[model samples]
Target: MFSPEGPGLRELAVQALSSVERGYDLLAPKFDHTPFRTPDAVLDAVAAALTRMGPFGNGLDLCCGTGAGTVVPARVCRDSVTGVDFSAGMLAVARRRALPAGPRVHWVRADARALPFAPVFDLVVSFGAFGHFLPRELPGLFAQVRSVLRPGGRFAFPLVAPPRPGSPAYWALLGFDAVMRVRNAVWRPPFVMYYRTFRPSDVRRELTRAGFRVELHALPEFGRRRDGSPRVRLVVARRPAR
Candidate 1:
């Protein structure tokens, strides 16, 4: 699941034992080489969808580890792109990573729960970072995102269908969340990544409660599951224009 340049078993063990911020700080250099980084295909897919909804201004990428999501706005947004994450190490790598030619991209070191901005962005996007937040944190987190967005602004992120019950993928995710729960129980400053906790229904309800008019856009690129459900769909939540 990791590239040759990725963190080793010993490194991963050390990271897992550390607090989330310190763990990411230690792992930042090799993060992009790991499966933990959001894939380029997903980035491109989001970029395409944003292009169709195009002509946005001043974009923000929440929890932008290594700035992978910045590209989505760079192509479509007319003003600037800002990537926010609390991990300085990750932001360092993101500051250095090359991006496709587009709007000027900047990095900000800040927490998603307390962003340092006004309602200024036309669009916001996050990728593969929700697992870090517990269900109870969604209200405050979504509110933070909402506060930084202009009216009618979009807050989008992709959600993939959870694996089928009894499937190998399902078992894998179950085991991972189980292990995470145990680790948090025994460890200090928990890593806070639980894949199963971020459900579609829960997300929709939370976003609605946070005052967004939620919409789902099918990302047909990943194809559908055997059950004929979309394998991946983009959640686009819009703040009220008024």
Candidate 2:
């Protein structure tokens, strides 16, 4: 689903064929018009949830493509905020957008696995970026986040419940992943984005091993599932204060 201003099918096909960085570069200008961008509703909901638990000093948005989730930290942090991503194109687009009235915002182009920063941030948040990381990379990825956070700092992100097996959504995601696998097998510089790899249980265990005390908070915006579990949850993983 995309707006008229979004990339055309031909443009999308070209992007899909390019490396992930270059593909995002081609799409950055029209990213906000595409479904690929994180929605404002989700951002607002995350902001609300974070606001309840914060008055943080400084914040970082890890893998902050187009800075959609940067607003969450800008709302909750007191001093300064930074948005980091590997794509210069995306960072350029993010830099052009006017930020809300909050902390000073800076954009940096850097890989998430090897962030260039001190452990000085009080809060770190990411949205819609986990799919880029494979399951095997979770430990190093979580460690990178932990390394950039101050003692007692938090690394927060929202997770939606996976679609039930046999559901249409389930089939759709499975098919998407299958297609991606086949595409990567035949393509150069694989574009890694999988919808089903980031399970909560596995993530929690990895976060724990990364030295974070993890907690889950229900986001009331999405309500509950039939099984009484929250449809959406904010995973708040804190670095030890000591």
Candidate 3:
């Protein structure tokens, strides 16, 4: 599912073997050409939803690889926008791109577990980055996001519905996670990315514990599943405006 400009299979293999930081560093240059980049459609849809809820001031994009999701906040936030990620290489690539008109853009290199910022943001958004975090890490990660947001600020992200059991997509994800588990068992520095670990119910509970008033908004652009559930839903978790 990659373009010719994307990394080759050999390059991908090398990346998979490296530490998460180094692997992303090696892959950063070609990341936009790969399926790893968040799609513009998803970004645009999120931006539209945020616009309805916002007149947000400063915004932040956590784990902003190549800054795709940063565009959403840039569209909604009137003041400044920042992107934070652990990978210097990914941040470097994100910094090189031209941003859409909205706010001034800044890029920061920091781990999501321990962000370096004041609680000044009015909105925050992330895309396709949570898979890097294990289930046990969710509480701390959500706390970190909550810590950086001003009272009344939001932490938003989209969640695609999980594949139905016995489907090809389900089997593929299961197989991928199985391979990753085996690899981590046998490999050096573990590269953490799993498909099925982030469940909506678990996430909502953790966000609640992290002090966010969570809400779900269905994104109509992706339509519904056979069961009539939203194919995609946006999680808008707001810090209580005390």
Candidate 4:
């Protein structure tokens, strides 16, 4: 359990035993209370960054769990905003939390690997959901994102810098990934979350291969590490202007 309002240990155990969609369905109501939800500070920083780069016409929130990451688009997009995810339970929670009206918020249930929309969105963003996707999925995933965007459109997300070896954060993430590996080994319909799967270099390469121009912006709000590397950075991969 993360907080008084969060799901308890027993509840979490039950969730872990279920399929990923079902697990989130079980956890959806209490998800925001947990540390797993994207923090408001990160969201605010991203919103600020987008405000400077935007006046975007439409936006999409990829894999928008509980719609916490989806709200940023509603604020900056002029036409419409959509949150798409594979989990119906997560979408249900998002629907409840989303505003009644304004720029037309819609929730579409679909896998990110094969997005249904045409060249629609001007900007797209995701948060705290990458671990769910394996490295091999990146190419198709990036391609799908590219397919959904218009010329010069963007797909952006916040990524924390990998923890240095010998650091506490590094070991902690390693331990978590190791445990998840063991859990999936014995469990059916693997949950597919690994902390170390997505490296920035590999991601950039994949994005480039998928036909996007990639750029990074340091999120200075999180400050720098001992080596002066930013703690967090925004990955902005743009579809070509042509």
Better of 1 and 4 by lDDT: 1
- Name the runs in model 4 displaced over 4 angstroms: 98-101
- lDDT of candidate 4? 0.91
Instruction: Give the Å shift of residue 184 in candidate 4.
Output: 1.3
Q: Give one clash count per candidate, in the order shown.
A: 0, 0, 0, 0
Q: At residue 136, give the lDDT of candidate 3.
A: 97
State the RMSD for candidate 1. 0.8
Over 1-242, each residue of candidate 2 has an lDDT whose tens digit, in order, gives: 89999999999999888888999998899998998788888899999989999989999999999987898999899999999999888999999888889799989999999999999999999999999999999999999999999999999999999999999999999999999999999999899889999999999999999999999999999999999999999999999999
TM-score of each: 0.98, 0.98, 0.99, 0.97
- Residue pairs in collision within model 2: none
Q: What lDDT tens digits, residue by residue, belong to model 4 across residues 1-242?
A: 39999999999999888888889989999999999999989998898888889989999999998999887888789899999999888898999994535588889999999899999899999998889988989999999999999999999999999988998989999999998899999998777778899899999999999999999999889999989998999999999998
Candidate 3's error at 63, in angstroms?
Answer: 0.3
lDDT of 3 at 20: 94
Candidate 4's error at 166, in angstroms?
Answer: 1.4
Candidate 3 scores a C-alpha RMSD against the true structure in Å of 0.7
Question: Which regions of candidate 3 are displaced past 4 Å?
Answer: none
Clashing pairs in 3: none
Candidate 2: list runs displaced more than 4 Å: none
Sort by lDDT, best first. 3, 2, 1, 4
Put down candidate 3 lDDT per residue, 117-197, tens digits, no spaces. 989999989999999999999999999899999999999999999999999999999999999999999998999999899
